[model samples]
Target chain A: MFWRETYIVFRRQLRMALRNPAWVIIGLVQPILYLVLFGPLLEPIAGQLGAQNAYTLFVPGLLVQLGLFGALFAGFGLIAEWRAGVIEAERVTPASRTALLLGRILRDVLQLFVQGIVLIGLAFLFGLTGSILGMVFGLILTVLLGAACAAASNALALTTKSEDVMAPVLNSIALPVLLLSGILLPMTIGPQWLQVVSDFMPTKYIVNAIRELFTGDFFTITTMWGVIWTIVLFAAGLYVGTRTFRKENA
Target chain B: MIHARGLARTFAGRGRGKEKEEVKAVAGVDIDVEKGEIVGFLGPNGAGKTTTLRMLTTLLKPTAGTATVAGFDVATQSQEVRRSIGYVSQSGSTSPEARAGEEIMDHGMLYGISQKQAEARGRELFEQLDLDGLWTREPRAMSGGQRRRLDIAMGLVHDPTLVFLDEPTTGLDPQARANLWTHISDLRVRLGSTVFLTTHYLDEADALCDRILVIDHGSIVASDTPDALKRQISGDLVELVVTDAAQAGAAAELLARIADTGVDTDTTSVSARVRGAGHEIPGLIRALDAASIELESIEVRRPTLDDVFLTLTGRSLREDA
Candidate 1:
């Protein structure tokens, strides 16, 4: 019954997404810009990192970045729904609270993957190539990470109940997390202290894991740590999201 | 059907540096509603009508006491209560971007109705609510009245035994309000559902409700049929606007002998409640003529729900709102 409602809600949202093509286009612009403008600048360092193509090294971080930035902003739409009484209307229904949330977060995950695939296709056109297995693994990690962020973002938005506070707080946290995750450059090439700091950032595990997967080192320690951290983050995010949703509806 | 006893809701007050205080919004409200009846929950703004409705609908937990909506405990068996009841919130529930028909259908689907059944139900509601052509339009593209009709349609799609509407016609014009009132009045007749609604419009309550519950502060100040409540004030209202400003006091004094309460006198006006409205007008005219007060005009008016509220709370409902 719960899954049925979740699927129904998922389909409704997907239909809305299809109706609003501008959102999809806007979601694609940032990742495509990175592939177009920033991919070529890293070619000199590509040889130093022992990679024939710099696009392969850059694409993984961009995928994680896509998920991180994309999911963290999902709450803006929810806040609008809250103000419009859509959330209140849903609360008065017999639908499970878990389903209400799972449906929305699942939509965000699907959006991330679709846009991630678009970014990957653009990378291919720009001369980026990698093991198909590695690319799929990276895409999977990004979706999971995006789902976790989207869930946490929704919880915060509900608590604060204001876009004014949510926007700045998310930016403050997102920028530092992005920088420390080494999306622009690998942390290993930076100072030892900076690398130590990056170890504490959860996205660093994801970035390193995706980079390994991009290089076809799927069975390595990086892959194990990446999967474990992503799982832990996803669990925490789902727990927070579900609890907040239940409390709000209750 | 709905029954609530001592239902109360309190929220932690916003405090800075001092101890937090609890603001009691719905304080010990008791209500009894029979099946197939339309009851209007009337109150001034901030008088806790919406809070009481929320508690009854199981959206907000009561701080104290208990209630049963549609025979299900609002506090314990909330899901059962929700399944049996539909709610139209103060803000219309339709999403601005969603087409009216699809949104109503989706609302039914949320309550476990099949797509084909929900669509059929949606069409039935649209026809009934006079929202036939609006199915393809988004709520934002429709007028305020159309949106409210869609809200009612959404609430009724599941065919619940009871429906709760919070200020269903607060912001509409008179014609739109009248149109919505007709549909609301038909709820009990067409579906055999109990309609519980809250509104600040006294005429809306008087025209549509079988009984009205008046809330002031946090408690229910009065509850009865609109006519019965009006009759509670005693005697018909009389207003006279005399030509002689100085003689108004004398006319008021003369009318006081037959007036049930003390006559109210302004510069050139005197008004009071008098028994036997049909018989008292002549004597009042004669008395004023005898005093040579020079009558301008006189009106004998029946007591309205507002008069009943004014008598009980010492304030007009309009000003209170």
Candidate 2:
């Protein structure tokens, strides 16, 4: 029943999302722009500075940036539904709280996946080729990271019940995560203290996980730690999100 | 069937930054709704009608007492209670972007009905509510009345044994309201589902409810069938529309002198509460004549639910929130 409700809500959300062509167009185009513009512009600096790989570094940062943006927007749709009294209606039904949360997270995950695919395609176009297995692993990492961030953002949205708060909060939290995750540049290039701070951010692990996959460094301890952090973040996000929802209903 | 006793719910104001004071939304109250009965829970705004409905539907837990909906305790067995009832709130719940048929089917599936059964039930309800032609149209495109009908259809799709409708016709036009009552009546007759409804429309309750419970200040002030409650106000109400404010006051004074009747005066009208209108009408007209109060109009009507509420509570049923 949880899966069924999640799928139905996902379908409904997608349909509603499609009605606004601007969102769809922006989502499809923004990641491509990040890949094409940011990747090439940083390539010269990467080579001169002996950076690991420009496209490899750029892809994870773009993925986290896009994922955070997408997850942050997830709450607006829910708030709109709440204001419209649709959420109240669903509450009166036998729909489980778990199902409700699952549905919302699934919708965000699906959207993030679509955005990731567009970014991946653009990455290949920018001469960022990878082994099929590496590409698959990277995509998997991106999805888990995106779903976690989206779920966390959704929890904030449901609790606040204000889109104005959600938008600014999303930007404030996501911007720093994107900047400090070593997505645009290698963490080694940064000051030691800054790298330590980046280590505390989940985006750092996400970027590292995907970068390690692309570099065929899957056996490293960092990869194992990154996987553990991804699971921890996803679980924490789901827990906090669900708790916020229950609190709102109360 | 539904049973609630000493039900109470208090909501704390938003945010930890505020004080810890709580607003009592639903105070101690008891109610019993039998199977296959339509009970109208009547109250003015803020009288705790919606709050009580929320408790019975297991959406809000009672702070003090117990409520068992469909034989499942609301606090302990909420999921079972939820499974057994359908709730339609004052705010319409259907998604504006969803087609009417899709909304109904989606709710059916959510309530645990099989996909095939959900589709079949959705189609049947759509046709039953006269929504067969507009199944594909989104709610935003439908008329207000159509949207309300679709909401009702969605509530009924799961075929629950009990349904709670909160101010179901508040904004509906009279014709639409009538149409909804017709569907409600049919539901009772066909499926024998107990319907617990709250509304400010006394006439709607008079026409449709088997019993009416008038609540005030978080308490049930009166509960009885419409006829029995109305009869408690006296035989009939006679309104002597006088020529002016002074004349209406004079008329009231004259009528008050008569036996076994009470006269209440207002700005432009004087209403006399009398028993056995057949005998009182002659005496009332004589008193008006003696006071030289020219009666512009005279209306002798049976007591209505409004009168019963007015007499019992000393206020109108449509008091502002």
Candidate 3:
């Protein structure tokens, strides 16, 4: 019943998304803009970071950018749903409460996957020289980050309950996370104290791992930490998301 | 199909030190409804009407007491209760972006019905509810009445044995309200669905409900058929205006004999509630004429539901609306 309910909700959300896909296209603009505008700047510094090219380094960071910021704003949709009484209506149904969270997370992950691929394809056009196998592996890490971020965002939406509050809340969270995770530049280029401060940011591991995987470097401690952090993040996100859904109006 | 005893809910007062103070939203009320009955809940704002509906529908848990809806316990067997009932809330739960028919189908499917059956029933409901040719229209694009009908279609799609509508016709124009009333009555006639609805409109209850329950200040104040409740007001209101101020006392004295309640005199006008005013009024007018009292105007009004509401609660329904 849980799986069936999840699939039902997922299908509904997917259909709604497909009907008005303007948001999906609009969501990709920021990452593509960064890739097109910022990739040439990273070329001169690529060799300094010991990479074959800037695309390999910059593309992975853009994936993290798409995954984090794109899915972090998923909460705004939820607040709209709450205002529309969509969540409260579903709560009255016999549907599994946890299925509501998982179904939405899966949808977010799929969208992140699509946006990541588009970013990757555009990166290759510019001059990215990365392994096909490694690119697929890197994309997996991005969607995992997306699933976690989307789940966390939804939990926050329930607590805030108003778009006026949610927009500024996500803004405050996005800035610090974007800078510390080194989404645009490598944290290693910064001073040691800065790197130390960024060490506390869990997103840094995923970004570093994606950059390594793009260079066909796998089976390393960096890759393991990234994989572990992703699983932990996804699990934590699901836990908090499920708790909020169950706690809501029970 | 529904039975509840002392059903109640209490919320911790919102904000700061107020959290320690508990506010009773539903202060214990008993309710009962047999199958195929259309029951109306009438209450003023903040009167716990919605709170009681939430408790019965399993959208909210009662802080006290118990309820059985569709033969399942709302607290312990909520899933079974949910499967057996449909609920359309006050706001009418439809996303502005979703197609009306698809929203109904999705809602039905969420209750464990097959997609094909849901679609079939949704289409039939649309046709019956006069929502034809609007299958693909989004709620945001529809008129106020159309959106409300779409909401009703969503709730009825799965064909639950019992349905609850919270202020279903609110915010609608007079013509739209009249149209929805027919559809609401048809539910009990066509599908044998027991309806429990809350509304601010007295005429809606008189027209649609087999019985009405009046709730006030977190409790049930009165429950009876609409006609019976109207009868509870005792008499028609008779107001007499005298041509001269000095004649107000004479008019008041004459009205007092036929008045079931006390008569009121204010300068040139005198008023009172009199039983069987249609029969008693002619003699009183003659008595005034024989006493050489000249009358300015006289109005005798039949007791209405509003009069009953005023008598029971000392508050008019429209006061807080």
Return the lDDT, model 1, position A238: 96
Candidate 1: tens digits of C-alpha lDDT, residues A158-221: 8888999998999999999989998978888889999999899988988988988987888999
Task: Give lDDT tens digits, candidate 3, residues A1-250.
Answer: 7888898888888888999999998998988999888888889988897677998888988999899998999988888888887887888899999998888888888899989888898888898887888899999989988998999999999887988988898899899989999888889989999999999988999999998899888898998898889889989988888899888373
Error of 2 at B110 (Å): 1.7
How would you encode candidate 3's per-residue C-alpha lDDT over B1-321 as one tens digit per residue? 989999999998777854478899999999999999999998877889999999999888898998999999999999999999989988768889988888888888888888899899999999998999999999999999998988888888878999999999989999999999999999999999999999877778988999999998889999999878877787889999999999899989999999999999999989999989999999999999999999999999876656877988887867876
Better of 2 and 3 by DockQ: 3
Candidate 2 chain A: minimum summed lDDT over ten consecutive residues — where? A46-55
DockQ comparison, 1 vs 2, better candidate = 1
lDDT of 2 by residue, B180-227 (tens): 899888888888889999987777887789999988778888889977
- Give the interface RMSD of each candidate: 1.4, 1.6, 1.2
- Estimate every model's Cα lDDT from 0 to 1: 0.88, 0.78, 0.89
TM-score, predicted candidate 2 vs. hidden true structure: 0.86
Q: Name the top lDDT candidate.
A: 3
Q: B211, model 2: CA deviation in Å?
A: 0.9
Indicate which candidate wins on DockQ: 3
- Steric clash count of candidate 1: 0
Candidate 2 falls in which docking quality class? medium
Candidate 3 — which pairs collide?
Answer: none
